[model samples]
Target: MRPTVHDIAAAAGVSLATVDRVLNQRPGVRRITREKVETAIREIGYVRDVAAANLAKGRTYPLVFILPASDNSFMHGLHAEIREAMIRSPSERTSIRTVEVAAFDPAALVTALEKLADERPAGIALVATDAPEVVAAVDRLVADGIPVVTLVSDLTGSRRHHYAGVDNIAAGRTAARLLGRFLGDAKGEVAVLAGSMLVRDHRERLEGFAALMAQEFPKLSILPVLEGRDDPELAHMLVADVLSKHERVIGVYSLGAGNRGLVRALKARASSRPLTVVAHELTVHTRAALIDGTIDAILNQNAGHEVRSAIRVLKAKADGLAVIDAQERIRLDIFLKDNLP
Candidate 1:
């Protein structure tokens, strides 16, 4: 049988109230008394019943998530996930709030973080752009004992506690291998479209794609990366410009969002040319495009899974509990026309 708090208190020669105070880190306990209670806890192998403790304390985890205000399908999906969480929040004792800021704006994100810090939420989650100011802001939040989890995109060398997202570098390598195999030894240019280099995910994807292309598909040349800021109109204009300049473009890879614009450009330029198109995310537009042969392959990250994982981590941290690492892993989902889910 597991040892109870009364058993630990008796063993430590301390009162039940003292044991409770020491275990919960509450005030009015001497350092020596705390050390004695801790030693007794370890000796008796006392594990706090987290659910019972939470019930007794009536704890409600307050969390904030910051997302980009881009009109892209990926951001929309993320927002939908947050809405779903909000729906289920009441029963879970979790209070979650979302803040949207301009995409790729580090100053605005920092300001949002500062505002969240002022409010003193128990935890924060954000889709981070790689910026020193944003990293510092997150570090400050951490220093103040608030758990910060990076969602979708990560900030390197930051004090963020956890990252709930797929491995973008591996996703890019997979895309490259798929594209290379689909275009069997075809010596043509592949047009690349990205959201922004400031985002670590996009930059990592570009690196992985370039590395694979140099190593395996030396016959194919990757054109200069077109930055669309994850905007559909900008992506369409960039694809059109690239197609007009390079008639030998046999493939296109969109490492970020904006598949709506990609599909538009592809349908407009379909002149008996078998171009292999690969993109990220499985949105309504991308799904339709895949079925109609506008897109050949899609490398996707489940937005719902990412958001859920972020919330779970935040709640666990707020309760000062260890999370199940395996359960919190975000996986990359590959989709094709035949296997669309």
Candidate 2:
């Protein structure tokens, strides 16, 4: 196989971004670093022909990011990362526009997707809501020759060009293992909190978590999943009610945002024994919960990395270039109190 930019970066002992800057002849690289990249390119026999590639795709791309309009900390962080990407857009020769719709509202998401389809942006990166209408809209975009990538959450049966997120099933199984081990021989019940079942990621997570729990930890009972819609107040109320109703509940696997509410409910509960909580995403609330012994483990997908990966994938698809799958894969991060960053 021909050496790609990744090979050049590895050979030069530099970052992928730096390699891009050097290859694109963008500013801000030190003379030594530029020389090292060039030397690596020559040694690896990596023929970039960036001028030809640029000439092939002469138009600047206008990409759109459709994120959920939620007050959740994770959503805020995702938006912050997208803003950072916007800041770096000039160097990438792309302009970004962001649209926000209500979280867990499938109709709203479908409407937003339809609106973007009419505009026909070069590429679209979306945090998808699993709905038939949304999927149809994605099909329309794909048919129109527009690159569509799902960010964070995925939509099945859609012609999306790529999914720039973690393997959520693995994430769920990992969460279940952490919670099960944390519980040890103790047997009770595990309550699950999710954002919405409409999202493929959340559904896949619950499936993996339940399957593992049934397979490995047979003694532990899993309660029906409660949807919090990624809302803190709703999550707090649902969690509080579940805790109140089930005295034997010993663990919680939160597969979505609304951790602020989960933490609040746990704190307000009048129980002598604490529940083993394994939750998704590392946010301010989840981190504090982990530190204070309210949450056991945090399964995290780095928002910045996901956003950056989506942008990279979309740009590559827009330019009719192949993306390095290994380089674009987003990692699932597991954080404990000791390993918090």
Query: Per-residue lDDT tens digits of candidate 1, residues 3-56?
Result: 999999899999999999987789999999899999999999999888678867
Candidate 1 Cα RMSD (Å): 2.0
Worst 10 residues of 1 by lDDT: 51-60
Writing each residue's lDDT as its tens digit, candidate 2 over 1-341 gives 98998999999999999998998789999999999999999999998765356755565779999999998999999989988988887777778989999887889988888888788888999999998888998998899999999999999799999999999899899998999899999989999999999899999999899999999999899999999999999999999999999999999999999999999999887365678889989887888888988888999998999988888888788777888999889999999999987
Q: Candidate 2 — which pairs collide?
A: none
- What TM-score number comes out for model 1? 0.94
Compute the lDDT for candidate 2.
0.90
| Candidate 1 structure lDDT | 0.92
TM-score of each: 0.94, 0.84
Clashing pairs for model 1 are none
